[model samples]
Every structure is written in C-alpha cells, then in structure tokens.
Target: MISLRKLAPALCLGVALQGTTAMAEEVLFYHDKGFWSEALAKVGDASEAATGVKIAESPYSSAEQYKAFVQSSIASGKAPEMFSWWGGQSLNDLVATGKIAPLDDVWKTAIDSGDFPASTADLFSVDGKPYGLPMHIGKWAVLFNKDIFAEVGVEAPATWADLEMVAEKLKAAGHTPFAATVQDGWRGFIWFQELLLRTNPDAYAKIHTGELAYDSDEIREVFQLWSELFAKGWFTDVRSNREIEDFAAGGAGMYLIGDWAIGLLESNNLPIVKMGAFVMPNVDASIPPAVIVEGSPIVFSTEAGQDEAYIKAAEYWMSADGANVWGAASGNSIGNVNAEAPNEILSSLDASINEMGASAVLRWWELVPAQLQGELVAEFNSFMLDPTMEQAEAVMANIQALNAEYWADQ
Candidate 1:
C-alpha cells in the first residue's frame, strides 16, 4: 500500500478522503500518471457529475508498485473496493485470494446489451463466470511518420521482407532504421512482442498462458531473429542512448510501437496527419500480423464491504456510453462493440483492425504467470547490453524452465 505518510495531505486526513475515519466504504481506483489514467479521471469526473458517485483515487507507477499496494492492503482488510486489473492468470490469482468479487451479473447484462466484444469479455472470465470488465479490445498497430517515410522513400511495409528492405534503405540514407529505447527494460518488449507475433502467433499465446514451453524452438527462433536484427543494426545499440526522446527527435524512419505511442507523437508535435499506422510488419507476409490486445481490466472486491454505489459505478463503467466517453478522452481505441468511436481516424483504424483480427490472434500477456513477464523482460534487457547468438536462446530457455517450475507449484 502507498505509505500513509507519503499520501497527499488531502488523502491522508482531509475531506477528500472518501472513506470515513472508520474506513468502512471506499473504492480505491488507481492509475499511473499516464494518458489512460488522466483520461479516465477526465471522463470519470464527468460521469460523477452526471451520476453523483465519487470514487476514491490512488495513483502509482509501474505494475510492481500497484501489486505491492494491493498485496499489502489485503492483510489490513483495507483493500480497495475496486481497481484496474487484467485477465487470465492474473485475475485467477486474485480471485483465489478471496478478495475479488465476481462480475457475472454485470457481464451478463453487458453481453446481452452488446457493450463489449465477446473476445475481450472472455479474457476476464474464470470457469464461464466473468470477473472483470473488458475495457479496450485493441490490436497493436505500428504508428509511423508518414513524412519521414516519404522523405526516406519508404512506404509502410506490407511484409517482413518489405520491412527489412525499408530498414536497409533507411540505413543507406544514413538514418536510424527504428526508434527504440532499450535503456528502459520494459520498452524492449515492443520489439520482442512484435517479433513473437510475426514468427508464430499461436505459439506466442500458448507460452504466455503456460500451455507451451517458452524455451521451445519456436520461441528460440523469435529471439534469434531479434538478435539478427540487432546484428544488422536495425535499431540503436543500447549503450549509446537510454531514452526514446532522442530516437523520436532523431530523423529515424520508423518506430514499431503500439497505438498509445500516438499520445507521445502528438505530445512531441510529431505530425500524425502525415503519420499513419499498420499492423506490425510480419516476418513473413504469408502470415498475418499478430496483434496484441493489451489494456487493464477493472476488478472489484468484496473485501472492502463497499457500498452498493461502488457496484453501480462498476456497471456504469462497462456501459456503452462510457465507452465513447473513455475513447474520446484517451484518444485510444476501446473494446466496446456497441460504443462508436468519436474520432474518424481511430474509427477507421478500428474497422481495419477488427477485420484482420477476425483472422489473426492476440498474445495474452496477462495470462502469463505473474513475474514471468517481468523476468523475461529482465533477460531481454541483459541481451540488449550485448546481444549474442546464445543470449537469445539462453533467455527463452531460462524463462521456460522457471515458468515450468512456477506453474507446477500452483
């Protein structure tokens, strides 16, 4: 939990506190100081204005911090009434702890009303009972600089072969081929996920869900391809720079990142009008680009003895109207099947994304046993320091072994 001493004065003891001195009824809604949280606060505030419901706010950065706070609070019986969560094993673990409440009733209504996509809703279900709300059904799209691509004489790559050709052409023109910030370890995952998606999408999903071995030949191949890209100087070496700001500021040809990068691009005044998005270039065009559907799910709890208002708030969040409001506020695509996107660009993209999504698949990150994603990221970081042929294989093998033991213990 956030150290009480570190809490803002208003939360520590002042009137902003939603729960009483007895701390009986409160919903601790958390967000990191990012676009999503800020956007949530913006639209959620409007929701409150209309509905007169107040949710207590707590913020933290990094999933580790969020997990630490949640875990600590469970012991004190001061657990949050509801907070952002994800599906797969992550939600299963929480439910097993007996703190979380089932969302079957709300979800049944949502499904019947067509508020969310079934694909996304299924992620939050445990044994056919929904435990969380599906927020964003997003497909990873590579946002690139159109002006930069045009200047470099590179069209959006249609396939992995085409992408390699573009990267080489950019290098010949004396430009960095890709914008990557390997200094921050988690950032390395953009490349890893992209490569994994390209090489074998189903295998990628399986490994994450503990159904397949992480160190298998398929996983090894993905890592090897990543190391090969480094060997070809596809992106900057890790030692030279730690921040993507330089990469963005540099006249790099492309940045293989998710849609959220739009916020960063617009914030930097990078031209999105000239910027365009496409599925990450597949290593083999014969294969469809694997899209990752990543966003946080909101999980409620019975531990806090929250007032009926909290449950109503959770239901309100999953409403179709809430979807449009959330999408408008964040400038990000949402998962609601019935919620019409407010922006033309996002709507168009969403249409194409869903069309391809029917044939392609999403790699479930939240399903990966807890700590596996973190540990794999760490190993990838170590490789960034000095990517060797063995480094790639070693990384996957270690993760596979560790996870095998991890799941057995469960």
Candidate 2:
C-alpha cells in the first residue's frame, strides 16, 4: 500500500508551511454548508493526519452565492484545490469548461480496491471520464415512526397494496400517512419521482433522457395516483416547514427522503430508536426493485490536479479509512462500500437494499437535464399546492413543453 504521507513533502515542493515549523501545507476546500462546518472541520483534521496535507474548508451559507463564487473563481483561473459539486448535467457543464480535472485513475483505484462500487462512478462521469470523488451517496427510503407503526398495528409494507393499507390505517388513527413539502422549491419532485419510479421505472429513466414524453399515458397514471393520494388527505400541508419535525413527533406516520436526511433528524433530536426505513414498495410488482440515489462529489480544479500533493490527497480521501472518518463526522454514509455505516438505522437500510437486489436510480433533481430542472420543479411545486386532476394535467402539459423546448435546442 502506497502511503500519502511518505510522498507529501516532495510533492508539496513550493507550497508554504503554516509557520517556520514543519507543519503540513494547507489546501483550500470550498463547500456550501453553514451547518456542516464543524463536521467538515473534523474530516479535515483526519485528512491532514493521514495525508500530510491540511484540508482547510471555506463554507458558504447561500448556495447561489457559493455557486457564483466558484464559477467566477474558475473563470479567473483561481479555483480552489477542491470543492463540493453535484453530478449529472451540473457536473457536465463544469467539465465542459475545461477547468475540472478528470479523475479516472483515482476512480479505478477505488473501484478495484473495493472501496467504492463501479456503478457509483457513473454519477460523476461525463463522456466516460469521472471528474470527482463521492462525498455522500444517499439512498431514498420511507422513514417511518416505529411507535406510530406499532400503534397502528402495522409493519413496513412489502407490496403496493400493503402500503396503501398501512396508510389508510394510519389515517384512521388521526395520523398523516406521510410528510411532504414544496417549501424549498426543489423538494416538490421528491414524491413525484418516488411515485413515478414505483409505478414505471422505465418511464422514470426514459423521461430524463427525453425518450418518454412527460404528457404520455405512463406519466398521467403517476399524476392520477398522486391526485388520489392528495384527495384522501394522506399527506401533510405542502407548504409546511415542519415536515420532518412532524414525522419525528409522531404526528405523521412517515417521511420519504434520502437517507442523508438522517442527519437532519438527529440534529432535531429525533431518537434513532424511534425511526425505521424501508424501500418504497413497487406499485408494478412485475418490475425489479429500485431506489433513488443521490450523490455529492468533491471535484478538483484542473490547476490543482497538476499538483502531486493534491493528487495524493485525493487518492487518500477516496480510501475506506478517509471515507469512514468522513462518515463518522457527518453522521451519514459515505460511498465507500467497505466503510461501516454511520448508524444502526442506516446499516439496516443498506443491508435491506442489498438483500432485495434493488437498482439505484439517480434522483430526478440531478438526473434531469439542468436546463429544465428549475422550470419543471416550479411546475411540480404548483401541482403539489393544488393537487387536483386538472392541475396535474396542466402541469404535465407545461412540463412536456419545457422538455420539448430543451431537447429541441439540444
């Protein structure tokens, strides 16, 4: 095994030390996070100890500002050594700028060593070259209140019919079957994607690539199911900011979100013992199981990748040891398959997903063409607030129009 620390000093060449003392050279890391600052700092400490390169973080509270700053910095040839970024079209755009470095070698190393699954590399790849390492790989599941399930005399559903039965029972017990919201705008697609995937996974994947029309029969069926759920009053107010809190307090029976939200639950003081997660059952049982997976990648600037020290540090960060340190600090699962899960709930969820042979579908927000994301999300938000058949029809038409315009331009 090659050691990063052994090669660090020679690779760091002209890099300045912290003081006159033999301190590790520091590299700037940019990310959009006001809440995870401390957690990231801890990860940085571990990186320095392992790689002989101090990882200094610069966090931004406003995502818009953070994106603008990063873009401008890259354009000015002053991009940070490393930065957190999204995958799919967003990453494609960054790679097209010729500023981001392709980390194919780093990816091959991790994949061959069994630290990460080869499928995960697809998330950060464009033209078959990966440009980043996974920061977080989130699996979407229905997080239910264990106490509420027990009170309703129900267990996690195994089939679509059982899911509806569980929901009806919870509703009868004066509990909302699920918590949902469109408050952040981007969240509107959560249920939309989940329901669509459960109903027609092929259509779900096809729609993102423009191979399936949004206004087709397959999509209409999804919207019809969504309307019926809303008509049954089984979901929380879409405008409410307390969706997670309501689920935590047992006011809502379940919340469908990425496992990364486990951190949010913990931050709100929700007891892990009260929480349980299950893969959303397939509405079309004939199809194989699937779960939405989202990834955040740490990308390197082209300039930074030229530095041997930065390359060594990136390699270290992709290893099981580095990923486990990050997982421990962030209270979330890292992409490394060899690393232990952050908590028992996540561990159980991972095992369940693997045991069932579920397919990992990318989340809609990142999977869809970037050009259409905002407009389509706005349409979804509108439909969530007015979940009528009429609104669903109109939203479908509007979304199809936007989708067509984007594909036409392409």
Candidate 3:
C-alpha cells in the first residue's frame, strides 16, 4: 500500500499551514500549478459571484510538494476543501483513503443539464462511485509546424509508413523529425505510450492492469521500432530542455504532445495559423483508430462536503458558465462539453477525432499503477538515453520486475 506518512513532513514547513485556517470562511482550492494562480483566481471569482461562497486559490510551487501536503492533510483529517488531482490509479489510490467524498450528486446535476458528458464520470470514479469533476481534458496528437511541412513538401501522415516518409523528408531538409526528451524524467513515456497505442492499443490498455506482460513480444516490437527511429536520428537530443521552443522556432518538424501544448506555442509567439495537429495513425491498420485523452480532476474532501456553501460553490464550478469562465482564463479545454474550445487547433482536432470515430484511451501516465510509475518512468528515461537493442532488453526486464512486484502485492 502507498504510505501517506512519508509525504507529511516533506512540505509541512511550507504549505501545510495554509490549508488549515482557510476552511473557516472560504473553500480553499489547493493545486500544484503556481503559474495557474491568476487563471484559478478568475474561476474563484466567478464561483463566488454565482454561489455566494468565496473560493480561495492556493497554488503550490511543485507537484511533489503539493501532493505531499494534500496527502498529509488527508491523513490528519484536515484535507483541503478542494484540490486538483490526476485521474486513473492516482485518483483510485486517493479514493481508497476514504477522505474523498463521492460527487455523484454533483455529477448528476451536470449530466442532467448537458454540461458534462456522462462518460466523463468514468474517469474520476472508483468502484462505481464518482469522487471528482474534470478540471481539464486534453487530447494527445501530433502537433506539427505547417510551414516546415510545406517547405519539406510533406503533409500530415495518415499511416505509419507515411509518418516515416515524412520524417525522412524533414531530416533531408535539415530538420529534426520530432521533438523528444527525458528532461523532466516523466516525458520518456510520451513516445513510449504513443507508439504502443498506435501499434497495439489493446496491449497498451491491458499492460497497465498487469494482465499483459511488459516484456511480452508486443512490447518488444515497440522497443524495436523505437530503436530503429533512434538509429535514424529522427529525434531531438534527449538532454535538451528546449523541445517546445525548438519546435516553435522551426528547429524541429513535428511534436507529439497533448493539445494543451497549444498554449505554450502561443506563449512562444508561434502563430496559431502555423500550427497543425493530427491523431497518430495506427501501425496496424486492422486496429480501430484511437487517441489518448488526459483528464485532470478536482476532488473534494469529505469534511468539506459537509459545508453547504462549499458544496454550492463546487456545483457552480461544474456548470457551463463556470466552465466557460475557467476555460477562457486558463486557455484550457474545459470538461464541460458545452464550453468553448480554448483555441482553433483544439476545436479542429476535436472535430477530426469525432469524424474519424477514434477511441479515446487514457494517457499512460495516469493508467499505470501509482506504486510503479516513478520507477518505470526512470527505466524508460534510461532507455531513451541509450536506445540500443541491449538497453531495450534491460529496460523491459526492469519494468516487468517493478510491475510484477506491485501486482503481486495487490
């Protein structure tokens, strides 16, 4: 089992105190994005205006510190009124703590009014009870530079073969075919997940549940293809921290990332007209089309659920008006189906996804078991740096070992 005690003291001196006293007069909205303070403040203002309850925004500098503080607070029976959390296994682990309250009632209200799709409930639910609402929903796609593609005489690829052809063309034109890095450590899984989903999405879905082995032939094939790409010099230097900036400046041809990166491109002064996006084509055409979806959820504490004012504010946060306010302020795709898309790229991508009938799979980061996430990510990062057949074998071995141990105990 995951221990909450270890995280309690890590950030106690910095953030724990802030969550305590705010519960008296306001609903404390604690989250890890310090940069999102202004955006969240706007949502808080709107919530207050609608519900007559003040929503206080508390932003933490780093995810580690924020998680530590939230875990510690929940352990001490003093959990914050509201906080943002990742879905999938992370949310499942939190729900197991019994501190998070089921928001089935709130979700019902949203669904009844067509504010949120009923399917969204599955993302934040554990054992059939919903515990949170979506904060942001992003689709992972191939974000490419239109000018670079036009210059190279290549358009968006519609198949795995076409993608390779595009990469070769871009490389011959003196451009890196793709942006890739292990800079933050967690990013090693970006391509790993994408390739696996494109090649064998069924295996990708089952592997996280321990029903499929990490060292199986299907996974080995993914590594083989990845190694071939590395050998061809199709990726950016794994050590570089400027993946997005390089792609923005035309140093790279394509970047496979979530639609959320649109905001980063805009911030870097990359014109929206120059950006294009497409869902990755399947390596196995026999399989159904699929796109990865990442959903960040805002969970409420059981203690906070007792406060009528806070509950009212949370209800407002789930409404279309509240979603519009938050989406406009944050430049994010709101969970509410009725809310406007944050940008033209996202709007078009959503339409394409619907038109193609692509299956929406959860991103691997959240789908993987919480206990094995960091260790497995480290293995993948090492593999990205080496990317040899020899290293591929060792990486799969280490991942399977960690995965096996976690599932054995479960």
Candidate 4:
C-alpha cells in the first residue's frame, strides 16, 4: 500500500486525527458545515465498517473558512484525501496547483455502475477532465412566507411590476418585503446577479466575462431597481444577520437565499409549511426567466496516495448510500440518480432546471475568475450597504477597472 507521509514529507502533522499513527492507513475527508458533522460521522462509520478503511471526517464552519484552510494546508501537503469544494473557477485554483487528481477513472466507473448518469458526470468535469464528485445542487430563489404575503393581500409576484406592487403592499402593511444584508460580502451578489440575469441573461454572462462593461446601462438598471426597494424601506437592515430568523419570526416577508438555507430553517424548527420558494421575476417581460445554479463537489487530493483504500473511501462517499446519508442530514439534493432531494423545494428546483433551458445560469459567486472574486464581492457589498445611483456607478466603475487590469494580466 502507498503511504501518504512518504509521498509528502512536509504535510502538516495535525491534519491527521488525534489517534492516527504514521503506519495506520486512514483516509481523511473534509467538508464545510453544510453537511452536519454528526451525519458525516455516521457515514464515516458505515464506510469504515464496510471497507475496513478508516475515514476521518473533518468539517469547517463555512465555505470561506474551508477555502482558506485548504489554500493554507495545500502548500504544506496537508489537504485531506477528499474534500468538498465549489466547482468552476474555485476549483480552477486547486487544479492549477497540480495537487488535485483528476477523477476521470472514478467517473467512468461510476457511470458504468449506473451510480450517476453520463450527463450528471459533466458537473464535475473541468476542461473535459473530471476532477471531483458532485455532492449537492443548490438553486437560488426567493423563499417567502406564505402567511405574510397573504396577510399583506399580496401573492408571490410573477413579473417585475408585480413584484414592485407586492413590495409596496407589504411595506404599507408594516412588513419588510425583503430580508437583505451586505455584511458577508457574498450576500450582496445575490440580488445584483438575480436582477441582472432577469433583465438579460446573455448580457449578464457577457458582462461577467468582460465582453461588456460593468458600468453598462443594463447593469445600472439592476442597481436602480434594487435601490428602489431600499428607498421604499422594503428591505431589512443592511447588515442584519438575522435574516433566517427574521423570515421565520414574521419580521420579514421574504428572503432571497439559496435552497440550501432551508436546512437552516428546518434545523431550527421553523414553520416549514409556511415557507415557499419561487424564481425571481424577470426584470424585462421580453426576456426569458433565469435562475442561478450552484454545485457542491468533493475533490480528491493528489498528495493523498491514490491507493485501493483511498479510492474505495472516495467511491463510497460518492455512492448512493453516502449521498442519501448526506441529503438526509443536510437537506440538500444529491447528484446520484438513485438519491433524491430530501425536501419538496429542492425537488421543485430540480424539475425547474430541467424545464428552464437557457435560463439556468451558473452561480456568479463561483463562476467568476478567482483573482477578481474578492474585489467584485467588495464592490457589490459597498453598493448594497449604501444603495444610491452614485454609489452604484462608482462600484461598477471600480469593478470595470479591476476587470480590465485582471484580464489584461491574463
């Protein structure tokens, strides 16, 4: 059997769990808190019992923290045998390090065994080479309180005008129509991306890739509409961290969050029956409806010797059993064909994605080039905190400047 220690001499020793010895072959698995730690512990126990390979489970509190840890640890050859990550440009960084092994063979076997459909395998592929196993698919939409909408005499809006009308009614009824926050930086992109894509999906794509300027009229319109919401007092406090709680506590009429956040409400024993999710309204009636899609995946570490034990552990984690275990705990939809989303909202999202055609855009949070992600987040957050035409223009100008510099260097 190949030994990881011998393969990477500088690996951080603490990466190994407390009881693991140099001679004992154990596969370390790391992920963000989306997968409840206890559920992972159960999966690890089951994997070990069936394969006789120890699976050490480690989890970080959030995606940002997980990314930071992975970035620092990879330099020391301390990346786990397999770890969860976002696909697209986020995975590009690790792939560039020459420390992430391609999972083409694993994909082929998985498809052959009927564990995943050939089409599903494409989610984990980069440049036609599979590099990870998809763990969950999250759809971005507005999760609204049914009772609050009804109480305000407003149904879920189907068009931009309808949405504006509903927001007016909700505000008149003394309710914040939307729960919003800019403190996390990433949260600021949700509305901006949604509005831009709804306005013109193709233009949104072009703008992100630098084919269109960030300060273009189309982009500015998104800010104008978003500012209107803030101007009407239809939004919660700009930095409110209690969005989920506010939505659940009847303090906010709706929340524009990912489907994954349903797990948070469910775990907190929120009134699930009162909540319903809907794709945001199209800003232009002429444009097609679009929804943002995000994928969570697990990538194999090259430094972790790809021996029989490590391979088996990774395969088992990506298997139907493992997917089901994760779905049951995380309230996330598993990519495995045999596994289904644990809730109705996710099932509805899956069906919509199949029907939406060109309307499903890859999430901007991870789709943008890594070098410009932080800058874009900061720029967007700045506008969200102070939603004004001046602030919006300045933010877009700054983003365009950064965009030009980064692409020029590229």
Candidate 5:
C-alpha cells in the first residue's frame, strides 16, 4: 500500500497526526481526474484531521483508467480501502463483486445529522442497502455564451418551438446552433440522453435498464427528434472541444454539458456573467420538464484489515464540511442538502431543480452497463457522423440487438 506522505507534504499530515500505525493503516482512496487538487485533497486533509486516519489519495487521469485500475485491483483481491465511483448501475456492478461494504450505519448517522438527505442516500444504494457516499452532484443543462445569444437577439429557449426558433436565428446569423463532438464517441451521448429525457424520462430509465426495448417507438421518437436537429444543421463541429473554444469563440451558440464545466469555463477567463445555463426544453408541452443529475460516489472495500479506517474516512467525506469543500472546489452542485453551493452557476442549478421539481435520471455515462454503454456510444457516433433516416433506423436496430444480448445475461 502506498503511503500518503510519499505523494505530497500537504497529504503527509496523516503520519504526524496519529503516528506510524495509523499512517500504516491509512485509508487508500482512489478517484478519477477533476478532484485531485482542490476538491478531494481538501476532503483528505479534513478527514485526516477529524479521524486521525491518514488518507492516501490516488487519482487516475481518466474515468477509463480509473475504472480499469479499480476493477483489476479488485480482481486481484487488492482493491483500495475506499475509492470513488458513479452511482446507479456502476455501484450495483461493484456490489455484485461482493467486495464493497455497505454503509448503512454511516448513512443513518449522516441522515439523522442532516449531512445528507434520504434522496441522495437512495441514489447510492442497491436493493435498499447503501454502498457509497456522494462526492459531488452535477445537473445537466444547456450552457450558452451570453454574448453570442445577444448577438443573435434570442433568449434561452423554454420550449421545443422556442428552441427551434432560437436555433434558426443562430444559424441565420452564421453560427452553429449547437456545439458538439463525435470524435470521442461519448460526446454523442449528451444529445441522445437529453432527447430521451425530453421525450419520456420514465421510459428513458426503463430502456437503459432493459425493462423496455431500446428500439421501441418511444426511443425511436427520441432519435427522430435528434435526426431532425441534425437535418436542420443545429450542431457544430463534432471534433472541437465542447466546453472551450467551440462555444467560447462563438462558433457554436450553445453547449450542452453538466454543472462541472462551470469551473472549467470560469478558469478559461470567461466571466461568470457572460455564461448562462438553462434546463433543456421538453419535446411536448404536456410532458413535465426533467433534468439528468449525475453524482460521483466513494465506495469502501470490505477487506478485513481496513474496515474501521474505511468507515472513518467515509464518514468524513460524507459530512457537511467535506461536501462544502468539494462543492467550492469543483463548482458542481452537491447532494448534501446541508452543504451550500460555491458559485452562482451552482446556485442557479439548485434553484432550477427545486423550481422545476425535476426527476433525477442518472446520466448516460454511469447509468448503462459498461459494455452496453460502449455499444450505445458507438451507434450514436455512427448516426451523428452521417445522420439520415436510414442511419437512424440502423442505429435503433443495432441498439435493440445489443440490449437484447447484454440484458439476457443479467
């Protein structure tokens, strides 16, 4: 096991705080990129201070790498004592391995103490047993450049017609109505997921989990809408950076992304006032609006030697202080109701959720089974790269085939 001291001096406090034994028994925490410096580090320091247990954090540079590392480690019977993961299907899959420890005791304490709400707790559970604690929450929306919108003389869209009108206006003004990329297959997922939710969020959930067919009329409607958007030339270069140059340079009028991008946008020197975000409009007026919410979780391993230390670390990470630190650093809304949002962007997200009463659907990245997710992304990429009625139908058929094969085993 790697020690925290070897990583950095700031993280080395674990040794001096409780001596060699506690440092040796340190809680090894692994997470994906975006949390290494400001977010998770702060939580690590706070956890060590509160529990006298050193936390050695190892952050992988990408989600793919992190997932691979954890899976391989677990297979080798050497997974970290605690590690970050996505909720929903991702957490359930980890639970199936029988290596993850249930945090029902810690969850009960957090709920009673008001550190977390029941809704957030339920998100990280499988079959009523809690498996992890949320590290941060993200609400997905359309982030537009205020300058570009002003130039086009259009406001944020609130309905499907309004969205179409705004798109036409932007295009007429010689700007891409939307910015997206298919070079990386996952980029296509943002559009597909939003369209699904806009069509029927309940059906979206059911289809992803295999309770409904992916090629059904409901899902076909989603693709038809997406195809229409493509036919109208609503999207920009699929290869450009979605959050940075593409939207920031006014090449694309709008960018659909999660709240986590707010920090990235702000860091790019775009003034907060110039960036505006809104919930994606529903496809039909009769359907209520809903937003996809994604939360990262930290799950614990049930390995014999590290249960107590893992529990302490999980407690600290799930507490109000940890959420506050994480929120302030990541600029993403947190699941802990008691924790305050760090910036205006996050504040707006929280307000929108409450105002719209949006039903939380797990984002596409984490909600789908890993292999099925890859297949879905591949199909979406194929359709976007050369969108046509023929391509859309083929993609739908492919999805049905993939879903049938994948779900049959489960």
Candidate 6:
C-alpha cells in the first residue's frame, strides 16, 4: 500500500468557527491563533454575511498542542467538525481515526474547475479517499535584507555560488549571515530541510517514507555540505543561543522563511526596501530548480459541537473574496488556489513565484509521512547545531533504518 503520508506533502490555512445566534452559528475550532484566527474571523464575517452562518473559533498554539487536544477530545468522544491545520502525516493520521469527513465532492468541484492543482487535493487524501479542501498554495522563498547586502558591497545573491560568496563577505564584515530562531523547534527544521530539497530531493523524499536510509551517500552529502557551510562560519549559531535580531525584530541580514515573513516584516514598520527574497540555488548540475511548500493552510472541520453550520461557513471562507482579505491582512501571498488576495506583497511575491513555473519545489516536510516527520527533523536538527561527518552519516542511516521499520508492516 502506498502510504498516503509519503505520497504528497504540504501544510496550513483555515476558516472561522460558527457562532450561536442565527448569524452566529459557532464552530468549535482549534487553530494556531494570531493571523490564522484573526484572518479566519474576517473570512467568517464575509462568509456569514453571504451564507448566514457565523464561524466561531477556539484558538490554540502550535500543531503539537492542538493535536494533543484533539487526541484527548476524541478519546472522550468529542471532536471539532472543522479545525485549522497543516496537511501531511498530520492530516493523514487524523483521517486514519475514521473521524474526519471526506470532502470528496467539495474537492472534485474544485479540481474540475482547475481552481486547485491535483497536488492540493492529494495532500489531504488517505487511501484514495478525500479528506480536506484546498486552502493554500504555499509561496516560499529565502527572504534577505537589501540594505545588508548593500552595506557589504555585495549584490543580492543570484545563485548557489552567490550564496557562498555572500556568506563569506558578510562574515568578513562580521555581520550575522543568517537570522534564525530555534525557540520554536519547527524553525530549525526549515533550514536543513530546505537545503536538503536542493541537495538530495529524491533521497530526502524516500527517507521520509522509510524507503531510503538517512545515512545514505546522498544524505551524507547533504550534511557534509551543511556542516562545511557552518564550519565556514556562515550560520549565525543562534540555534543554541538567542539570535541578535530574531525574525520579528527585523535587523538580521537574511532569513530562510515562508512568504508570510513579509507580513511580519511590514507589521514591524520595516520598509520592504530593507529586504527581498530569492530562490535557493540548486546544487545539482541539471541547471536550477525553484522549490516551495505548495499546499494550502486548510481548516479541518472535525465537528466540534455543532459542525453542520460551521462546515458550511468554513466552505465559504475559502472563496476568492475571502481569500483576498486574508492575503491583504497577511501582508503575504494568499496560499488559496483561487485567492483574490489583495495585498501588494502577495501579488509581487506571487508574480515572482510564477516565473519559476514548473521549477518551484515544494517542501519535504509536507510530503513525508507523519510518523517519519519527527525522526527526520531531529536528525537534521542535530546536524544544524553541531553538524559532524559521523552525525551526518548516522542521521541518514538512522532515518533509513527507521523508515524500514516504520513501513515494514504497512
């Protein structure tokens, strides 16, 4: 059996829960809070006006916390009809519980209209059964500071070699080359994982499914490259220590983050002139390929208390108009397949991403199985902090061994 978790990967985006009044039929929602909740509320307001269902949301922090709440709720025979979340092993795991309602018709309508790429629908499917709607088409890039490059008398990095050159120059000037936050365990994974995408994509994917070992030659090359880069003093080493300027603080030279980083940038009143983004350079000799996370942020309506009205509201929240408002508020590109997102940032970012065309790469975290996620992340994290040749080999071998064990019965 082809493990659904390993087939297609991507993550997040959602809708509001319904309220109690006729215009406020609340939905029980567990979300990552902040923008997701606030943006979803706005989407719900428009949706309510258009569809007479008010979406109400109960917020939470982080996927792990939300999922734990969900597990306990289910154990107690309770689950929210629609909730917000990423789609990877995360969604597939939930689908396996037989609690999630498949939105086959909803997705088919979307696919038939060409509103969503087949990959979007594939993210939430398990065993050929559909489970969620397409809500975001991830727009990703490596965000950097224009001023920093100018200060160092360097141009914006145009390729992989450019990255190495820029890193060396920035280091010589004694400016932190990269700004990263490890307080959030997920953030570090972004660095190693993104590089792995350009370094060893196929083996990386296979590793996620327990097919290839983490210690494989391809995997070793990935870490060797990363370790060599770090040993060159390119990284800020803020993973163990707090960064001089975190992603939110805005003074760091560069950050490899989602397009949503633009929103955080703007909200801080930092001028866009202060920053820009570029694609990661390909290490492969087959020219260069752009990569990004392609799945939408979806609100999984698991039926909290009263999900009927809430689900309908969640459906409406995904409309073009609703998505546009979300895009504007996000100060980032709307991940929605049919998003009429109005923000200039989103438009500009979207235009840039489109130019990459078929070369854009989606992230591995979203495509790999749920069970294999933690293992891969941990191994990568080790390499990121104190990367070693031995650790690199062990990481790949451990991954391969784990993958073999994980899929042995499946």
lDDT of 5 by residue, 368-401 (tens): 8876766688888888887787898999899899
CA lDDT of every candidate: 0.66, 0.83, 0.84, 0.76, 0.77, 0.63
Q: Assess candidate 3 and give its TM-score to the true structure.
A: 0.88
Q: Tell me the TM-score of each prediction against the true structure.
A: 0.83, 0.88, 0.88, 0.87, 0.86, 0.81
What C-alpha lDDT, on a 0 to 100 scale, does residue 7 get in candidate 3?
Answer: 22
* Candidate number with the higher TM-score (3 or 6): 3
lDDT per residue for candidate 2 within 56-148, as digits (tens), equals: 778987656787898898899767678998887888988888888889888888999988889788888889888988878888999998989
Residue pairs in collision within model 5: 181-238
Candidate 6, which ten residues in sequence have the lowest lDDT sum? Answer: 1-10
> Candidate 5: deviation at residue 408, Å?
3.0
Candidate 3 local Cα displacement, residue 269, angstroms: 1.5
RMSD of model 6, in Å? 8.0
The alpha-carbon RMSD values of the candidates against the true structure, listed in the order shown, are: 4.9, 4.8, 6.3, 4.9, 3.7, 8.0
Shift in Å, residue 232, candidate 1:
1.8
Candidate 6: residue 5 lDDT (0-100)? 16
lDDT of 3 at 409: 88
Clashes of each: 3, 0, 0, 0, 1, 46
Candidate 5 displacement at residue 410 in angstroms: 4.2
Q: After superposition, how far is residue 191 of candidate 6 from its true place, in Å?
A: 2.5
- Looking at model 4, which ten-residue stretch has the lowest summed lDDT? 3-12
- The alpha-carbon lDDT assigned to residue 343 of candidate 5 equals 82
True-vs-predicted CA distance for residue 153, candidate 3, Å:
2.3
Could you give candidate 6's per-residue lDDT for residues 1-410 as a string of tens digits?
11001111221111223333222344444566554566667765666677766555567766567667877866776555666556667677777776677777666666676666666666667787777655455566777777778889887665788887888888888776777656445565677677677776776567666667666677667778877877776666556444423643544577777776676666666566576777677776464566677554454534421345655655565556666666666554434567665445556556665775636555666666676676667766776665778777767676667777778878
TM-score of 4: 0.87
